[model samples]
Target: MQNTTWGAIMGQPFGVIGYSNLGFVFDRDRIHEYQTYWPKEETGLARDVYIGFKYQCVEYARRFLTLKFKAAFTDIPHAHNIWALDIIEDCTKEEGTFPFVNYPNGSKEPPQFGDLIIYPYSKEQRFGHVGVILNVNLEEKYVDIGEQNYEEAGWECPEYARRLIMKIENGQYFITNKRIGKPYDNWDINEEIFGWKRIDFSQKQ
Candidate 1:
């Protein structure tokens, strides 16, 4: 029999691995279901939900990396390591500018297993969004990360294929937006067991 604690999410494209409880093929191999907070529908409720999910997803992604890569993982050691949303926001911590702390840049050292991915909403470099590098390859420049409400949700846009398109010729990693088609039981649930942490961090205090 199959695992049935929760059901795979529906209405989206991709499968949920009941084992990990992560939503898949959104913009990466996996993204936190918390993203439901700021859905493409862009409803007021969605935005409100995003406020809490961002931070939780941040920690979740970090934990996921640590668990998946084990010895091959590098950590982001700052509470503010997440996206600034507003550039003027504080980034005073020494670690704020440190490696793997903030970036679209990959760590040149060991645990080079992944790179940092940033989605810039505004023209300025200090805001918008951030995500971790999931995978990369020279022949196929594709990146997979935990992301939400991708601007294109995997479509073609000016200068490049927005959303899920992986770089074919440049860049150090292979990043791609998740493509959605007919989904198979998309609902995914976690944290109901009581010991799970309810993460909340869309904006730092």
Candidate 2:
């Protein structure tokens, strides 16, 4: 199937609908080439348990954590079937599997690398979106993210994992898209963030 554009799927149903950039294979040789590949319906083992649709944001986040930190979060539901917000809830309920600490919107604690950032669902969207925190600079107040499903939109929208500027005021965190050589565009984290989950390996027992 041809890749669907952001505009084409804007008012339609959201969630993993086979539209991906990771193609079919989970190439360990080129695992770092996340941007070039589309997520497909491949499956594999993480903690001696089944995982979900490959190349999707949920799958990539889980595999990335398992491969990079030896942390396995197998309790999360199928990426293709579940809402993005439910992943956080599932992780929070799972005991002694993988540490999934949830920080609500406007959280004071800064997000760290490998954290799962959850976006809120809108009236038109049935499910929200997810991304992995690639970098965080509290001093500079910006974060770099790694995600799928958010492809480029011709000349308007940016591609996966753009750097976003963040701010903390009145005990709340806010974010803005940082475009090179252009004015910073404020992104409503207050409205967009349902919550963020961090993989705390320390909780594994």
Candidate 3:
């Protein structure tokens, strides 16, 4: 893909990332950026049901689903109460609200494109992490994800979304590389995978 201004702003190609069959086809024409916010305040804050609070992993995932598939979710807490695991549980309970189907790790069925990959927090961590699958290669046993906030690129980290690779082995999935970002790097595959949920477009009615 030709390097455009947006690609230069993102500091990477909006196209394929090398010979790896596992990669993403980013919409270079689209402006992909959002403000980062955390640590919910007691003061009243306006929340957009679709775009969500800027720069949050959950926000981006929700926005992606809404824009890409025209899906929406309700009854979700507007504040920090919405944890990564909460997303899986919420979708499971409110079946037809969002186009998500929960799948625990080690299931015979693996994650596919557009799946929301959630990582649970460890004892040292306070909050979990989340990402969206951009590509999945079952034969190669790997998945590419688009995520925000988990990295340590300063305050605008959320707008600086990037792709990372996750591996699957012995019917289990794990993130082997620690270079993607912090807090996320601290997550161990054995303990972090609370589960993943796929956005079933067919469910949209």
Score each candidate by Cα lDDT: 0.29, 0.49, 0.46
lDDT score, residue 108, model 3? Answer: 61
Could you say which candidate leads in lDDT? Answer: 2
**Residue pairs in collision within model 2:** 20-38, 21-37, 21-38, 22-37, 22-38, 22-39, 23-38, 39-55
Candidate 2, residues 138-184, lDDT tens digits: the string is: 78877766665544321122323456768778877765434333333
Please give each candidate's TM-score.
0.32, 0.58, 0.54
How well does candidate 3 score on lDDT at residue 174?
55
**What's the lDDT for residue 38 in model 2?**
20
Ranking by TM-score: 2, 3, 1
Q: Which candidate, 1 or 2, has the higher lDDT? A: 2
Cα misplacement distance, residue 35 of candidate 1 (Å)? 14
| Lowest lDDT 10-residue stretch of candidate 3 | 12-21
Summed backbone clashes in each candidate are: 19, 8, 0
